[model samples]
Target: MVFSTEAVMRGRGDILHGRPALVIGFGKLGSSIARLLQAKGVQVTVFDIDPVRRTQALSPGLHRRPRPRDRPDRRQPGALRDRRDSLRGEDFSHLRNGAYVATVTSSEDELDLAELPDVYTRTIVGDHVTRYRTTGHCFYLANDGNAVNFIHGASAGPFIFLIQAEILAAIRMLTREDLAPGIHEVPAPDREAIAATWLSYFNR
Candidate 1:
């Protein structure tokens, strides 16, 4: 959210307002980004390989939407997934290839640079960037196609502590309580309480 809006689009209200954005995927992360972009007045059109997910996107936009049986939308930034054809060959000059979207997609096909048409020139730019001049446009590719979100180092700021605390709580529960031998998601009340406590303490 911060990277795209702040680093690329320059923020939600100013340049992005009323503009149309094509979101490439419709998973958990993608849905959230699409919602945020919509909230900021950007018209969002989602492209997902799954027909179920596509149906879900047709729902009235809400924070808590239903699952595949009823679940709502998702979004990934521009990604070149040949198998799904979500963002096939769509070259982006504005945003570098942040492969966070690649991690989200299940396609095992590797990105073949040879397939990128008419790339007459390639130049090493930054530690994580390579400049490629195509037939008529120049685009940048992030090295290893790794997510740029970690550029700030391993620390994901104070919000990560909230996740850690939940993990700790889960471990404690596992040790102290008898949970049924199956996958159990953390209950909503527990999550709400933890978030409330974190906000009260940290917002100080």
Candidate 2:
């Protein structure tokens, strides 16, 4: 999701400086994205229902903690990274004009166009982007509100799949055979093994 956020920012020319960016869901993915945007000088706002979990992973900075109902305040977000996939068509009123909205977690229609308010214009803006103009506002939706990471969500890059599979296999292998361990971590060898697998695959 961090890489996804970076891709979105870079794709949009990194013009997010001093602009508000919304990150829905303050979990691992959303929090990481919020921090990255903040580091890049974009003012980030995170929305999460769980007060405890939301408050836990946030970085030491002035983070806005707005309740669900109070979201989409006066200042519209210039960019929106939705990890929670909770956006609706009615939510468009609070977004900045021409903001690129992408979902990081689910490859589902986070912002269903059918739910969009009666609009005068909807243009298919190239691959993976659709522009909709309602009244005087405009915004872009990536992959038809599907996840930006994998719009074809059924598949994943073989390299990433390899790493995740290897990690899971390693943990399974280690946990089943160890009895003298309680909370054993994947040591250097396991990490090196994973890296070696990647190196070999890349070389191949």
Candidate 3:
């Protein structure tokens, strides 16, 4: 697993030290990113479509920020809580101001990012599900994200994959070639030999 705990922490530290970061889709990667940011004295907020997971991973006073209910002067009537809960969507005004958003879910729905209101300057990241590549199959990288195809693995054994280009303009930018075919293949070696044994469990 290239996305190990240490690697995830290092990536989180890079963003935390650079700018204020927000993590969406709090699965393994998002959760780890948030915890690492918190450990390094960075403010982190988590949002997810799954309310149950959100409530579990992000509770009041769990981080350096304050929850709506935790503010002493801002108390809404009990009836308003139900109304507020019923209308559940992010107020994207702040996100529009350039909050970096990262997602770790398998969702390929473009609406999750494209529909954000006024979010013209936010950095967004999607996981492996966004682009899955296979051997001999051509692919095109988008302006937003790259394709990650599994090339070197088999149905029963471990292996690497290759990256191909579909669109010439995008391909030229990535490979610096004309409107020609491009192939990206990985070597047939174990790159994880130096990693701790715990990482192998993720592959399983």
Q: Using TM-score, give the best candidate's number.
A: 2
Query: For candidate 3, lDDT tens digit of each residue in 115-165?
Result: 433423332233222221233221111223211112212131222111111
In order, the Cα lDDT scores of the candidates are: 0.50, 0.64, 0.32
lDDT of 2 by residue, 38-126 (tens): 78787777677777756763644736556646355446554455544466667776677777777764535355456678863778866
State the lDDT at 71 in candidate 2: 50
Q: Tell me the TM-score of each prediction against the true structure.
A: 0.48, 0.63, 0.33
Candidate with top lDDT is: 2
lDDT of 1 by residue, 142-199 (tens): 4334433344352447888888888977886787566878877777888898899999
TM-score of model 1 (CA atoms): 0.48
Alpha carbon lDDT of residue 13, candidate 3? 43
Model 3, residue 108: distance off in Å is: 4.7
